[model samples]
Target: MAKILMITGDFVEDYENMVPFQALLAMGHQVDAVCPGKGKNDSIATCIHDFEGHQTYTEKRGHNFTLNAEFDQVAASEYDALYLPGGRAPEYLRLDNKVLAIIKAFAASNKPIAAVCHGAQLLTAANVIEGKKISAYPACAPEVRQAGGEYVDLQMDEAITDGKFVTAPAWPAHPALLRQLVALL
Candidate 1:
């Protein structure tokens, strides 16, 4: 099993992230829930209650918890894959130099990097999407294209994998995206 690192922000799509996180654990991979620090407080708050609305979200609760490690604290060499869930968090995360560095490190390492919806924003910010074909929420297409990625308009059931990168549209695509990510593991 691969050692996976799941990165999030203050408020990611609560359900979309949990499914893949749980699937990785069920597949016997060791997963770490990493997030950026807002301040001195080490605990990262997530809308746990809101996440329960989805069936897949409920199953992923076992390993659901926060890690104190800021983006800069994460070591790229320790993880086999990086997973990003889409939401407003990506917009904020993209501005942090540390997060961008981590993103770039994962891309440089050629490790499996999975992103969904707005999470693609961070990928674009890291400048690693150049010449790559990926999928994201329709509203984010222009940004992806501007970043040099070919954005595909597809159903959530469809999973898009290009090289070491994998992407999906939104919450509905969680299952397919998780399955594809597990296959990579």
Candidate 2:
């Protein structure tokens, strides 16, 4: 079983993230949900809703994912794969230099890195999509093209695996994306 680490933050797509995680777990892979920090108030930490609209909680596997752990602590060489779920979270994660460094390490080490929706934005920031083919949310098409990646307009019918990178469009394509990710495991 592969040890898959999923990185997420606030405003992440609750359902999109869970489908793949559950599928991987069901396949006998060890999946860990690594997040930035504990949530406040009534907000849940390290959990999201599944596609069926049920709440799914994540098991804490690492200290809060910050600039330090993302870059200096967590080594891409230690994991079989990395997964990034899209939403407003990517918009902020892409700006963190450490996150970018970790992303670059994943690309450099040739580890499988899967992303969806705005999550592909991290690939753009890490400059890992150059000459690669990928798919993201429609709004990010120009950005993907600008980053030297071919952006396809297909739903996640199949995962676009360019080298060690796997990308999908959005929530509607979660099933296919999860299947592809599990196959990799």
Candidate 3:
């Protein structure tokens, strides 16, 4: 099994955060979910983002997700891989230098990094996806291109793995996403 680190924050997409965390745990992996300013036992607000015949996804309040690790205590060396869940959080998390640093560390070490939907926002801010091809939420494709990465627009169930990085369009792609991540591990 691998030691995995998942970075998330307030308003993280509900399924994106919860499913990967639990699925990895069920697979006998050691997972530590952390938020920038949160610590062990701390909780982050989550939201449900889903399509409902609207022009865009709808958001509704979801469960309060608990952190099992402290962000400040995270060291990229301690984990075999990294997971970044998408949502409103990445819109802000991308601005955290510390978060970007962690992402860079994983890339430098050639460890597998899995990001979904808006999670690519952090990857862009970290400048780790340049010249790589990946899949992400359709709305975020422009950011990927702007960051010098080729964006592969795909349905929610498809995933793309280019080198050590694996990505999917959105939460609905969890099955493929996790499978790719586990294979990397």
| TM-score of every prediction relative to native | 0.84, 0.78, 0.98
lDDT of 2: 0.72
Please write out the lDDT profile of model 2 over residues 56-152, one tens digit for every residue.
3232222222221232346667888889988667888888877788788878888888998888998898899989988887778999999999998
Q: Which regions of candidate 2 are displaced past 4 Å?
A: 37-73, 156-158
The Cα error of candidate 2 at residue 73, in Å, is: 4.2
* CA lDDT for candidate 3: 0.95
Best model number under lDDT:
3
> Can you list the residue pairs that collide in candidate 3?
none
Query: Worst ten-residue run, lDDT, model 2?
Result: 59-68
The alpha-carbon deviation from the true structure for residue 66 of candidate 3, after best TM-score superposition, in angstroms, is 0.5
Question: Backbone clashes in each candidate structure, one number apiece?
Answer: 0, 0, 0
The full ranking of all candidates by TM-score, starting with the best, is 3, 1, 2
Model 1 gets an lDDT of: 0.79
Among all candidates shown, the one with the greatest TM-score: 3
If candidate 2 were superposed on the true structure by all CA atoms, what would the RMSD be?
Answer: 6.9
